[model samples]
Target: MYIVNEGPNNAPTRGTLKRRDIDDNTGGTPIIGIPNLHIDEGELMQGGQWITYILHSDGISQLRLVRIDGQEQQTLYCAPANTHIANMQLSYNGQNVVFNQYPNDGGKPSLYLLSLASGSLQLLLHPQNDLAYTPTTWLDNTHILLTSFIPNSGAPRNDLYALDIIQGSNQHDTDLQKLFSQNWSCGSFDVSYDTTKLYVANCDASNGLSATGPTTISVQPSMGGTPQPIAHLNQAVTMLRAVSPTMLLLMVENGSGDTSQNGLWRMNTDGTGLTRLTDDTTGGQSLCPYSQYAWSNVTQDSKLFALQETDPHSADRKLYYGSLDMGTLTPFADIADGTDMRLVGWTLY
Candidate 1:
């Protein structure tokens, strides 16, 4: 499972990697022992075979690769001293990856791509030191959309753009056309299946991705323009994925120890049909959800949904999964408390 902590002040860590097998619907336990190395950030490739991840716990910041089942693991790339890999995204085909290099010298994050098969890594685009162009999602097999903040830009201040790797060539882009802009900072956003619309996760002015304030779900043209609000929540959002063109899967932070309010949530793009997928009703008592799996790799059609939950204010944590056929959430595995083991992607079989 590819994941990140929605917890406040927590950086992505691999220390929490606790694996559980998908229920075969047979009467068997799902817990699998943990691994040794800590993974900072990672993603299961589209092929569902390879796992592309970054390691930063040690002195050296590195990018590595391996089979999802602990096979052929090796370091793919490592950052030089004073530089750390920012956001890394795997291509849909699993043959390539794009990441941003953050330099301690205060330069803008430079985007680069590495071809796994040939091991050819090259710098793609580098913006001025002041701007940050972070990858959000792939628009298709070849195009990716990145978001940047434009403070004081009248009305909507955020801007979006499509970066075409194949056709972009060696030239850098500072003049790419803007897709659209929103009045608030969009913590997380995704594209529609048809590739014509955008689903945005905008947070309150002060909270940002910290989940301290309110969050609003909205939609707009893919090419960029004003965003139309669809749904507004009282709390901040930690994860947002466009499961279908009209459906969104999100996680909101209700509060510490507030089991009735926090957990996984699903809703239609229009903000109607809002439903709480995880709740205290199943646990028989209030259970706090400190983290969640963010990548939308697995869904209801996969037959099970997993949420990491725990008792409030302590290190007690467990892996919880809901069966689509049965429509209920059940504890699956025991995990070390306080460790950040976000879903990096899962191999169903």
Candidate 2:
């Protein structure tokens, strides 16, 4: 398994671990180190051969694509002199990659796209200072869905937009469409495996970004329709993914010392069979302390590769794997307490 060691301390490191070395009761360490790279957040390309990630080193941030085995690397794009790369998403088909740029070290972030086949980078949308842009998921190889709202508007809602990856193409060979709009600001969204429905988290924006408010889970048509509520959550949702056509994987934020409010959860699309897969306890003692911030850092295979930060702000952390069918948990790595670990999963060694 591949894991990222990010810090409140040192340069980020990447390494690989053996799944066999892990068990439910004991933790393990990386078996090999990935040279001198200082980047972390990544997702596998559709073919599972390459990974796209953001690089933050020296005084620059870049969007990069690297081969899985560490034998080759490529810098697909780099932020301008005083700017840096921010949010990013890779199409499910593995052809295109899109991300945002924070200019002047501040201001609205603009969206950009890169073509893996052509090595071409294009500005898809300009940065709007008042409105915030967050890439949600790819509807298809050439289309992506995202939500945006006025930063700190304190309003109760956000708008969803669809972008065409191919310069001259439309959603249906016509024009991109607004899939859905609601009264609640949606933090993130996912499409069912079959790509028929949109699963979203409707959140509160009172504190600034809509992600911080009380969150709710709902599903609606990918085209346009009224939403069908799934569950009203007490904690803010940090990540939401559809595991199967009828099931979902949910991670909620509980950074504070409230054990009951955190952990990995799974439920049916209709909101049935909900289960907490880890201990969301707050403390310096609990073996598993889940944080919503790293929710997107995952890799799925026979089971799941995930983690739990010991505290909201500390480096104490652990890597674990669990059964998607039973919601059973097991510990794989016990990162040294105070050793900030920013991360992901996959097997390269």
Candidate 3:
């Protein structure tokens, strides 16, 4: 598996890439150790042959691609000065990438699509008036799920929409379809692996940006239908993903003073059984302490996942692996001493 260590505490935030052996559970070997490289906004392409990442230096951001073994690196796109690249998602077929570009100072964000083979770029969507669109994930090679919202309006509801890339040409040919029957406010959401159902956590966003109230978990057809309420959580759900058609994994914020309820949780798709997989208890006594989870950090099979947690020996955020069927974790590798890290994605290595 590959991971990116982000130096958030450093003078200028930078990223260090490393690779780990999942089966051995050993420390990671550094792959890239260049100066001023920010890799937090990158992902491994499907089939694990290539990687797409962003590089930042001197207030400029460039989109680049590299082979799996850290060779043949090339710049794919160069953004305008003072702009940043974010929310980059490679297509399922590994031929194209869709991402958002925003100015560092201030302004609304715009979406774009890039062809990896020819290095061609196209403007996909731009915000008009109060309405804005942001790419969330790719449903397939041709369809992408996006969130449509009115920025800074405190409306409490941000809807989901699907963008069909193959249906037409140019900006006018982009087909936007709403995925819900009514105005549904969702905080954390994921679609089933088969793309049949959509699971949503209705967290309170009264403050416009953060989830501050109880959350209700619901399931509905991915296209559009009546939502079926499943589980209700007192703490806000920060992250969640569908492990399968019948199971889900979620992480709730540690706000209720329960050490056992801080890290990771797993439950059924229909909300039958709920289990705690890890906790915030430290001192090397808990299963996983000070853990952090990501939406796309799981393996290809979805049975295993990678997360960052404090290493008891070094006090740095390290990579840990947990199973979908068990709560115990196996120590893998420390990301970078005294720096925060994130699992980019799993590869065939």
Candidate 4:
């Protein structure tokens, strides 16, 4: 995994270890920093054939694709000056990648597709008065589920929309259809591998804000059907991620006070058997929640990867792997200081 350089000596803050291949997993000599680099997002594509990351350098953000083995780094496409790329997704075949680019001067963000072989970039969708920000799971090679948010809204009141890759003579026809509309604020949604079910978390009970005591987890069909409330969490859920068809990883806060005291929890997809994962309950503690967590199912073995903070200021956050069945955790690596690391997933080719 590639990480930005933000340490004491400007060293590249990155380390790699093979758990099954090494006995002393923490013996590697640390590299300091890689200069003039910033990685915003990283994703695994095409069943882990390649990993893609967005890098910001020289005042521009460019998409960089790398082989899963940490070899063959290549620039896929670079955004125009003064524009920012939002969420991105790679097709199942690994031939295409799509992302949203927002102009600095303010306007709607447009979706663009990049061809991996030809190094060509094309505009996929450019909607007026609406901006696409979050890239959800890919429905197919030619379609993706995304979230559209209104500009200047302080709260995250976004609607889910599907974008068709096939373009028409009329621009309006390119925008596909709205999946589901919610009255509350929602973010961080994901779809199942079969593209039939969607899991989304929202605080519909709070008026334009996320507060404790009222959050809903909804399971809805991707084709615009009635949403069934699978679970009504007593505490406000801050983040929700799908581990598989039957399990979800949730970060929640008890509504009585600040949510930092809240830890991690796991539950069935239908909202049954909620289990808390963390025991830390100190208020105003930083747990490095921005880092992404993913579950790995290889050889019928289920494991989870996450960034855990051993310090309050998050200055000593490290990666950890845990067994889902036993709930036992082992430290993987200590991500260097000054760099906020977000682990997407392990690429097993």
Candidate 5:
């Protein structure tokens, strides 16, 4: 796993990137240090040799590609002022990249695509009829899954769509196909490793932007089919990741005013054998009140993960790494004590 120890007060996002072996109880080795870097907003390439990310500073964002060793860095594209780039995703083949860009006007966000080989950037999709489009996942090398909804409005109606990049590589016009339109907001969703089934966590949008009550986990054919509800949870599920064709990992909100239910969980895709792997209330080295987490990789068999926790009052951060079924967690060392260290994605290698 790799972590970014953000710089001090002056340049918080500028700092050192380090890699660690979870199996070893030692501190990580430094990889590279970059200024104005948004480590979390980047994707590690397939071969783990390169990373494509956006750098935001002084109100401007730049799409950059850099080797892991901090050599041969290339600024692929620089956005105009007032443009915020986010939710970047590299294609499966590592040939193309897609991301969402929101303008300063707070209107609908636009999606853009960049070709790494040719360095050709194109306007992929622009919202129509006041809908904001966000790139969710790459179903294949050519097809990208997207979710559309209104921004900032109460209970924005959500729907799923797929964009055929090969057919829509031209400017501003996209070949889109609607996949689901039930109006129930999908808080989180993922496709099976084989890309045959889609797992979605549906939330009630009648009250507000967040889920009001129980959230339902459903499975359906990725192309299009009737969704089957497999499990329903009382807590709000902030994240849902399909770890394998038959297993899933979830991060549910601990809203019961306690740490008993605060942590990660695993469950079978068939909705059976649901169990909490990390029980902060009763386990060793509690990873309670964590703000974010990421699996080692997106592969179906991935079970290793890393999570980040921040001290709200002191504003300090910590990182922890462990594999599935291990209730106990060991604190990662060598992380600059007072700096803000963030858990970035794991390397494929």
Candidate 6:
């Protein structure tokens, strides 16, 4: 099953969620999850004047893009051949799209790029041995920061590498520069707007592949520099986004107790001034960290969008848009029935 939501303010009015069996011989019956929510404004466009995302069928993966209103676009922008497309990010201008493609059968993965204007598809990296996943962010229009995992080693872990897309083609191998090697899995990372520093989440305390201690979020300069720990959380920090050089958005699970009830937190880049945004104490369901949330630029301030699962009665998910104000939160749209809507990626046009 796959779904796509426009954003907090631009949701669809009436659509159907169909679930089809992929292996069925006769093409089985389609199960509808929920109705689609409508948006008053049209779809997003190429320029940095609107916002939009691409929802794929895997239910947990998606690609982000910007498109014009009533464009009647198809799902071929970043389609991975014989693989599942996950973890996508768009360039600042929304012209280039980068994502990770994992083969369905099993093998080392590669990074892919899509030219929205030219409709050209290219593979950026095809590792000889290790498997790559979870591309952090675009350092520039031609370079991307990513993590690769080499299996069977004593300590299987993710290492940071910079992939230069302009150096090679899909038929040939590209150049990959090893930036830093770590003992733990690299969760999420973001590059500064000026491309000077990088903020990353990792379990850097232990020696094994799976570090047992609380995850540490840190920032390092693009040039050689020590990684300074920004915040130490009791639980594992799964996802993070840098709203600016001074602010960060994070999703944290409880370290001591229940892991299902993850909470949303915002804090300064240096780890001071921590603020809790969402509380899941009562009955609020946890949002999908990868596919449910995004931050956008609106003038000087930033806006947040997510598929909020308010309560059990709220049809599983609704598109929500809110301001980045400290104490106040306002909803721009309430999608009554966007159940199958999985956020792939977002672009500010």
User: CA shift at 258, candidate 1, in angstroms?
Assistant: 10
* Candidate 3 ranges beyond 4 A from true positions: 2-14, 149-157, 167-175, 181-186, 205-213, 254-260, 281-295, 310-315, 335-337
Candidate 3: lDDT of 268?
Answer: 90
Question: What digit string (tens of lDDT, one per residue) describes model 6 on residues 1-349?
Answer: 2133433423433332222222242211222222344211112232424334444342233443323231343444534456666666666556777666777666566777888778787876666644555566567777777666653344444667777767855522336777777644425666765678877777533333322336788899864378999788765565677766577776564433455435567778888887777654423423333421223322234544342345454554443333455424443223455333432223332
| lDDT of candidate 2 at residue 72, scale 0 to 100 | 65
Whole-model lDDT, candidate 4?
A: 0.59
Give all TM-scores, in the order shown.
Answer: 0.74, 0.75, 0.82, 0.79, 0.82, 0.65
> Model 5, 1-349: lDDT tens per residue?
3546465443566745566655454456666666765454656676567867666665677878877767798888887788778778788778998988788777667888999999888888866566677777787788888777778775555688888887764434235788887454535777887788888887654345444436789999998899999999876565687766677877665434334565678889999988876644422222211111223333224656555655544545567766666645556853436665655566644
Name the better of 4 and 5 by TM-score: 5
lDDT of 2 at 233: 79
In candidate 3 the C-alpha lDDT for residue 34 amounts to 67
Put down candidate 3 lDDT per residue, 140-227, tens digits, no spaces: 6788788765655655436788888775334532357888632334357777767777888877544344444477899988877889
Local distance difference test scores for all models: 0.60, 0.59, 0.67, 0.59, 0.66, 0.51
lDDT of 1: 0.60
Over the full model, what C-alpha lDDT does candidate 3 score relative to the true structure?
A: 0.67
Model 4 C-alpha lDDT per residue in residues 1-349, reported as the tens digit of each score: 3243353323333322122211345422222223556566766664655667776665677888766555677777878899978677777677887787888777667777888878877777766554544555577677777765666555464677777767632244236688876543523455665668777776633555545656778888866787788888757676676666677777665535556537667789878988876544532222223222232221123354343444555565455555555545566556545445444554344
Clashing pairs in 5: none
Compared with the true structure, model 5 gives a TM-score of 0.82
* Evaluation by lDDT, superior candidate among 3 and 4: 3
Q: How close is candidate 1 to the true structure, as a TM-score?
A: 0.74
lDDT of 2 at 232: 83
Give Cα distance to truth, residue 245, candidate 5, Å: 2.6
What is the number of backbone collisions in each predicted candidate, taken in the order shown?
A: 13, 1, 0, 6, 0, 12
Q: What are the per-residue Cα lDDT tens digits for candidate 1 across 1-349?
A: 5333323223433233234556554422212222333456767665456666776654467888766556677889989899988678776666778888888665667788888889998887767534567676677677777766432332333567788888654436654556765443434677777777888787654433323446778888877677899988876565677765566777666433233565667778789987777654333222112111223334535555565555555655555667534538776555455544354544554
Stretches > 4 Å off in candidate 2: 1-37, 127-129, 149-157, 167-177, 181-188, 203-216, 232-237, 254-261, 283-302, 347-349
